[model samples]
Target: MNQTLHAIAPEKGRKNKSTQDDVVYAHIFDAILEQRLAPGTKLNEESLGEIFGVSRTIIRRALSRLGHEQVVVLRPNRGAVVASPTIEEARQIVFARRIVEKAVTELVIDNAEDSQIDKLNQLVLEEQECFSRGDRGAGIRLSGEFHLQMAEMADNPPLLSFQRSLVSQCSLIIAQFESGAKSHCSYDEHFELIDAIKKRDKSKAVRLMMHHLDHVEKKLSLDDDNASDDLKAVFSNVRGKK
Candidate 1:
């Protein structure tokens, strides 16, 4: 994984508990979105505390936030780990994404400013560049970011927050059950959606959004199961050196 663990030195005068919690949450959250922390990978609180130089309480706070988003699961005595959605759960999540994003598309057309559309175009260009350089992990994460950007442009806080959770859950689903020949979100389709929004073509934009989601869901191999469970191995490169 290209995502690196930034130094969260315990002695850096960082006495703010909330700040530490946010840093840990952002790192693990980005790792999951980038597929660095694969589904079923254990996120041991003690190990994470040692890695980030924080107490288990802080790690638990971060993990609790992730668990609330359904991207991480916390067990009573077993500790926390990245979530692995079941096949049925995967289907429902994808279906829910399509619904929410379709609404997001319509909202964008109605509410988005020209500047917002321009920003989205820039994001697509960056996403395409990532793919061209063989950075599929970053590309996939940017692909999901495109969808979230749409939610942001929609000017609906509730929808944006909900989409955040759904997008992460879908990432876990894709990581666990995607076919070998993965069908990533196409940058071209993203450009087309942008065009439709520019023209205020609500129906076309909504159609494209749903169709894009259809392609994503079709690429998943729901019957298969795959994951990594070793916290040490998974986070070896991710953890800062002592």
Candidate 2:
């Protein structure tokens, strides 16, 4: 796991226990979102502890938190691995996202300030730039962030928390099912929803949000039965370089 460790290590001299745990969690979380850590990739605590220069306890805490969010599965003897979502769970996740995001967009329209709208617009522009530069991973991560940003604009903590979980799960689903040619969220659709919010058109915003979600869900090839089961092959490139 040397390569993965080198890639994710905290900067020199920044070693606080709590901070290290958060860093470990965020690193794994972002890796999952970017599809760098694929579904079924084993998260061995000892290797992870070595990688991050932390202890098994810190690794356990981070993995436990991910387990709580359903993004990682903690099997007793098997240890933690990236969650491989079932087809049914994928459908349910999309369904929940549609319901929650429709409400989120409406609340954003009602609660967002001018500056917040500007921030959303800026984020889309950055997302577009990521796509244009052929950085698909960053683009995908930014796309997920767009929905989270909308939830934040709503200023509802409970809703924001729920939306965060849904978004994280959707990342796993996308990793599991989406074809390489497919992108996460369409840039134009995001701009259209922002435009509707700018106009404070509740009906239009909700309609566009739902349709946007439908468009995303339709891009996945959910029927594929081939998921990687070889743990060594899955982590080959990312781990044990040095």
Candidate 3:
């Protein structure tokens, strides 16, 4: 009786802590995905704790989650920072994405309902609007979301999970290595993908997916260099959202 209550009490406390950690994790992940927190940006634990209004323990847990997902690199003595994938790593990431996203395309075409397709169209519209308004960060995030949502529509939990991490990594990769002013994805290409899915043209959808990935990969050059440790200014928008 007393023993059982004590065990359950500890579990409940852990659950509450985990829930708080998830909120913090999502904010950081979305910030990275949106390119607001640029690659190589230092993520100061104390600053994050103050911004999120949580303890350092909670902030650490959230950063740990991001580290595990490979978007944030955890340093032993230096703490954590946004991961800047090396050029070689960037190549492999795109290669892996091509494989996974092709499968995701096929599955989505087979499983996605018309309503789901419509929802994807709506996402593209929003992405176009964002780009038109010069909100490139928001636009790029929405472009990544379009793919993530397609993975979700594929009806495979494992694939969706893989995409959740891969999309974030790719976004980071683009922010680090992309050349010139090219965008990560074209909204027009996204629309064509939806049309192929709507018509259940698996071959066309897969082809479009591959070509789209190739464009994104080809835009990467080694000329970019970025470094910033202004943690609060980097996360200013994220802090305002809290």
Best by lDDT: 3
Model 1, range 137-162, lDDT digits (tens) per residue?
Answer: 66766777788788889999889888
lDDT of the structure predicted as candidate 2: 0.74
Candidate lDDT values, in order: 0.76, 0.74, 0.77
Ranking by TM-score: 1, 3, 2
Can you give the TM-score per candidate against the true fold? 0.84, 0.82, 0.82
Total clashing residue pairs per candidate?
Answer: 0, 1, 0
Candidate 1 error regions (>4 Å)? 1-18, 34-38, 180-185, 222-227
- The best-first sequence of candidates by lDDT reads 3, 1, 2
CA lDDT of 23 in candidate 3? 70
- The window of 10 residues in a row where model 3 has the poorest summed lDDT is 1-10
Better of 1 and 2 by lDDT: 1
Could you tell me the C-alpha RMSD of candidate 1 in Å?
A: 5.1
Better of 1 and 2 by TM-score: 1
